[model samples]
Target: MITLLLADDNPRMLAALVQLLQREFVIVDALASGEEVLAKSDTVCPDIILLDISLGDLTAFQVSDQLRRRGCPSRIVFLSVHENPEFVRAAIEIGAFGYVFKSQISRDLVNALHAVAEGNQFFSNSET
Candidate 1:
C-alpha cells in the first residue's frame, strides 16, 4: 500500500479526504499546518504528500520548498481551491506530481492520486 502524509488547513475537508483515502492508502499521518508537515514528515517517511495550498500558517509552496531543502524525498501532490494557471505552474515548478482543485475532489482526486502514485502526472481535466 502507498504510504501518504496529508495536510490541509480546513478541518472538515481534511477529515473527509482521510476518510475517503485511508482504506486505500497507508496514511502515515495527517496535519493541519505546514509546520507539521516539516516536523512530522521524517517520522512518517511517506511515499507521497497530499498538501493543500493554503495551509493554515504557510502556503504549500513554502512547505514543499522546505521539505525539498531538507532533502525529503516524498513526492508532493498539491490540492487547492484555486484554479489559476499560475498556481499550477508554481506547483509544477516545485515538483508536484499533481495539482487538484477542491471542487473536483469528488470526481478527480482519487484518479489523480492513482495516476501520480504510479509515476504519472495528472494536473487536472483542464490541463490536457
Candidate 2:
C-alpha cells in the first residue's frame, strides 16, 4: 500500500482527508502545521506527501524546498482549494508529482496519486 503523510492547517479538512484516504493508503501521519511536517517527514519516510498549499507559518512551497534540500525521496502532491494558474505553476516548479484541487478530490485525487506513484505526473486541472 502507498504510505502517505498529510499536512493541512484546517482540522476539518485534515480529518476529511484522512477519512477519504485511509482505506486506499496507509496514512503514516496527519499533521496540522508546516513545522510538524518538517519535523516528522524524515522519520516517517512516507512514500508521498499530500501537503496543503497554504500552511500556516510556512507555505507548502517552502516546506517542499526544505524537504528537497534534505534529499527527501517522498514524492509531493499539493492539495489546495486554490485554482490559480500561478499555484499550479509553482507546484510544477517545485517538482511535485501531482496537484489536486479540494473541489475535485472525489473525482481526481485517487487517480492522481496512482499516476504519481507510477512515476507519472497528474494535475486536477489541465492548466499545465
Model 1: number of clashes?
A: 0
At residue 22, what lDDT does model 1 achieve?
A: 89
Give the clashing residue pairs of candidate 1, or none. none
* Model 1 quality (TM-score): 0.94
Span of 10 residues, lowest total lDDT, candidate 1: 119-128
List of clashing residue pairs for candidate 2: none
lDDT of each: 0.89, 0.91
RMSD of each: 1.6, 1.8
lDDT of 1: 0.89
Task: Report the backbone clash tally of model 2.
Answer: 0
Looking at model 2, residue 110 earns an lDDT score of 89
